[model samples]
Target: MTSPHSKLHISRSLNRFQTQITIFLPRVAVSKMTVVHIVLIKFRPGVAQEHKDTVIQELNKMKEMDCVKHHRLVVGTSITVPVERSKGFEIALVSFHENAIELDKYRNSEEHLRITTTHIYPHQEESIRFDFEVAPEEEHLWTFLPIPAEN
Candidate 1:
C-alpha cells in the first residue's frame, strides 16, 4: 500500500504535468483586429493572350493560399486611368491578407514568383507593383466602387 505522503506527491506531479500540457497547447484565440493590404499590379503592355491566361491562372491559385484572407483580381478597362502613362501598366488589383506578415509570406510565396517570372516577365513590356496599408474603417471603401455591367 502507498503511504499518504507518497499519494499526495504523485497527485502533485500529475497536476503539474497537466498544467504544463495546458500551457503548451496551441490556443485558438481570434485576432482582435487585422491589417489590410492593397496591392496594385501593372502588367506589361501588349501582353499576349496566352501569357495573360497563364498569369490569370496563376493568380487565381492565390485563393488557395493559407495566408490569404481575401483575394480579388481586377483588370483595367478603358474607364480606368493609368497611374503612370510612360510605363504603360495595365492595372490589376490584388487584395489579400489583412496582416503584413501574411502579405510578406504572399510576396515570397513560390506561386507568386512563378507567375511573375514565367508569365508576367516574359510578356510584360513593363510592370510595377504598389502596396498600401488600409485601416479598418477604410476596408469597405475598397470594394465600394460602382461599375456598370457591360452588354
Candidate 2:
C-alpha cells in the first residue's frame, strides 16, 4: 500500500541521520562575565617630544593604581586612505577593569584629571574613544579554540 515517493523519503532520512552521526561537533556555552572598555587616543599636530614623553610617563603611572586590570600603549602602524597622513597620535591607551563603575572611577580620579589638564590637554589637538561590552562568546571563545600566537 506504500507509494514509491514514501520509500524514497524514508531512504533519504536514514542517509541524513547516518551522515550527522559521523560528524564531530564542538561544545559551546554562554558566559556571564565582566565588561571591557576600549579607548582610542589621538594627539595634536606639532606636539613636542617632551610633551609626548611627559604624557606617556603620567599614563604609565596608572599601572600602580588599583582597579586597572591591564593597560597598554600602541603607536599606529598603518595609515588610513583618503585622509592626508600626519605624524599620527602620540599614544593609544588600552585599559581593562572589572566593570563600568571601576572604569568611571579611574576616569574621574584626581590623578587622571591632573594628568589630563596638566600634560595631555596642552599638547594635544584631537582625541577619540570607543567603548564596548564583552559578550559571553567573546569572553570564552578562545578557551575552546586555539588562537594562533602572534610573533
Candidate 3:
C-alpha cells in the first residue's frame, strides 16, 4: 500500500484470491522506485486516424531513449468501461522509467521536446498526465509465481 513496503494486500476478486506481505528494509535496500508515467489524450475534432497514428508512432520511439526503464512503454486506445468516464479522451500512453531522476531526464530531454513540439502539442485539444512510482519487489509480489517475461 506504500513505497518501500509499509503494508499491502494483493488480490484478485475474480478468483477470490488474496495475499498480504509487508516488510521494511534497511536503508541500503530501498534502491529507488520504478517510475510510471501515464497520459490520456483528447484530440481536436476531425483529426484523421493517420495523423493520430503518426503521433503515436513518434511517442513509441521514446521508449528507445536511454533513460527509459527496460524500454517499457504502452500506447493504446481508451477502453474504459462506461465510456462516459473517459471524459472524451480517446487515447492513453504509459511509460516506465528507472527512477524519478530518469523520469525527469526523459521529461526534459531534447528528444522529448522535439517529439512533443513537432508532433503532439499542435494537434491536441487537451491532454492529461499522471505519474506514480512502484517498488520493484512489491510489483513482483503481484504474481504468486514467477512468470516468464519476454523483455
Candidate 4:
C-alpha cells in the first residue's frame, strides 16, 4: 500500500498534467477555417470575345498553384430558372483556399497581379468581389423524411 504522502504526490502530479492538457486543447480544437473568394467580372462594352476567353484561361492557371485548394471559372449564362437578379456580369470566379494565410499569399502572388492588370483589368469595366470563411461541414446525424411524389 502506498503511503499517504506518496498518494498526495501522485494526485498533485496528475492534476498538473490535466491542467497542462486543458491549456493546450484550444490550439488543437480551433483549427484553421477555410477561405473562399468569389469574383464577378463584366468586360467593357465592345471587348472582344477572344480577350474574355484569355482572361478566363489566365484565371484557370491559378488553380494549378499550391495555395489554391480549388478553383472554378465560369461564364454567366441565361437564367433558366426564373430568378430576378441583376444581369450583365459575364464571368464568375470561385476559388477556395486552405486557410486565410494561403489566400493572402495567392492574392499577392506575381502571376495573379500580372494577369489581373495586363489581361483582365484593362478589359473589364465592372467587378464584384466577396470573400468569406466557409463554415465547417457538419455530420448528418438527423434522419430525413421521405418526400411525397408530385401528382
Candidate 5:
C-alpha cells in the first residue's frame, strides 16, 4: 500500500523533438517508493566456511541484476544485543526493488534460482523472509508483518 501522506502528480514537458509527451511523477512516492526483501538465514551445524562463502558470492550477483534496485548481504555481528532477537540466524540479505513487478522478476530469475537451490539452500537449516512496501519517510511503519520462507 502507498502512504496516504503521499500524493501523485503528473506534469508534461517538451522534449528535443518539440513533442508534448512527458509525464512527471510525484517526487515523494516516485522517487522513494520501494519494495523491500529481507532474508535471515541459519546454516545447519558443521556447515563449512567454503559453503558460506559461496552463498555470499552467489547472493552478490543479485545486485548486478536489472530488477534489483539495491542489495546488501551481512553477517550477524552481535550476540550481546539482548533487546534484539535474531533467532540465532547468522546471515542476512537485504534488497530493494522499485516496485512489486521488479521484485517478482527478481524472485523468478534464473540467477536467483541457481544460487539458492544449488549453493545456499543445501547448507541452511532454517530461513526467514520478510517482504514489505516502504513509502517515503515511513521507515517505522511496515506494510505487512510475518515470518515466511526466504524463497
Candidate 6:
C-alpha cells in the first residue's frame, strides 16, 4: 500500500520546452511525477584525472536543460567511506526531473550524447544508471494533524 501523503502533492515543471502539471487524488492515489536519476562511473586504466574533470564539467552542462528540476543535476567524485565498498567507481551524477518525460528528454538530448560518446564512453570502463520516482517523507504527513495532550 502507498502512503496517503504521497497523494497530497504533485510535481509541476514549467520551462521553455514544455510545461506540465500533474494532479493526485488525496489519500487515494499517488503521483509518481518526480524522478531521481543517478549514474556511477569507473574509468578505464590510465585515464587521467584531468580528463575526468572535463567529463564532470560537461555533465554539469545538463543543468541548462529546462527539463532538469531546479538545476539539481550534480556531478562529483565519490567520498564513500570504507572506500573498498565503492568497487573502483570514482565519479557519480545525481539529478532530479519533474517526470519521466523530462528524463527521456534529457537522455535523448544532443549534449548528453556528445558528452557520453565523445568524453565519457571512451574512458568509461563500467557505468551504472538508476532512476526512480520520489516518495513523500513520513514526517511531513503529521505536520497538519492535531497532537493529543500529554497523558
- Which stretches of model 2 miss by more than 4 angstroms? 1-33, 70-87, 140-151
> Model 4 over residues 86-116: C-alpha lDDT tens digits?
4567778877787876786687676787788
Judge candidate 1 against the unseen true structure and give its global Cα lDDT, from 0 to 1.
0.55
Candidate 1: residue 79 Cα off by (Å):
4.9
Question: How many pairs of residues collide in each model?
Answer: 2, 1, 0, 0, 0, 0
> What order do you get sorting by lDDT, best first?
6, 3, 5, 4, 2, 1
Could you give the candidate ranking by TM-score, starting with the highest? 3, 6, 4, 5, 2, 1
**Tens digits of lDDT, candidate 5, 74-120:** 33422546634766687788887878767866876667767777877
Candidates 2 and 3 compared by TM-score, better number: 3
Q: How many angstroms is residue 112 displaced in model 3 relative to the true structure, after the best TM-score fit?
A: 1.3
Runs in model 5 lying further than 4 Å from the true structure? 1-32, 70-84, 137-151
C-alpha-based local distance difference test score of model 6: 0.78
What is candidate 1's TM-score against the reference? 0.55
Question: Which 10 residues in a row give candidate 4 its minimum summed lDDT?
Answer: 6-15
In model 6, which runs have C-alpha deviations exceeding 4 angstroms? 1-32, 136-151
- TM-scores for all predictions: 0.55, 0.57, 0.69, 0.62, 0.61, 0.69
Candidate 4 C-alpha error for residue 84, in Å: 8.5
Candidate topping lDDT: 6
Off by over 4 Å in 3: 1-31, 141-151
Clashing pairs in 1: 35-98, 44-125
* TM-score result, candidate 6: 0.69
**Residue 75 lDDT in candidate 1:** 41
Between candidates 2 and 4, the one scoring higher on lDDT is 4
What global local distance difference test value does model 2 have?
A: 0.56
For candidate 5, the 10 contiguous residues with the lowest summed lDDT are: 10-19
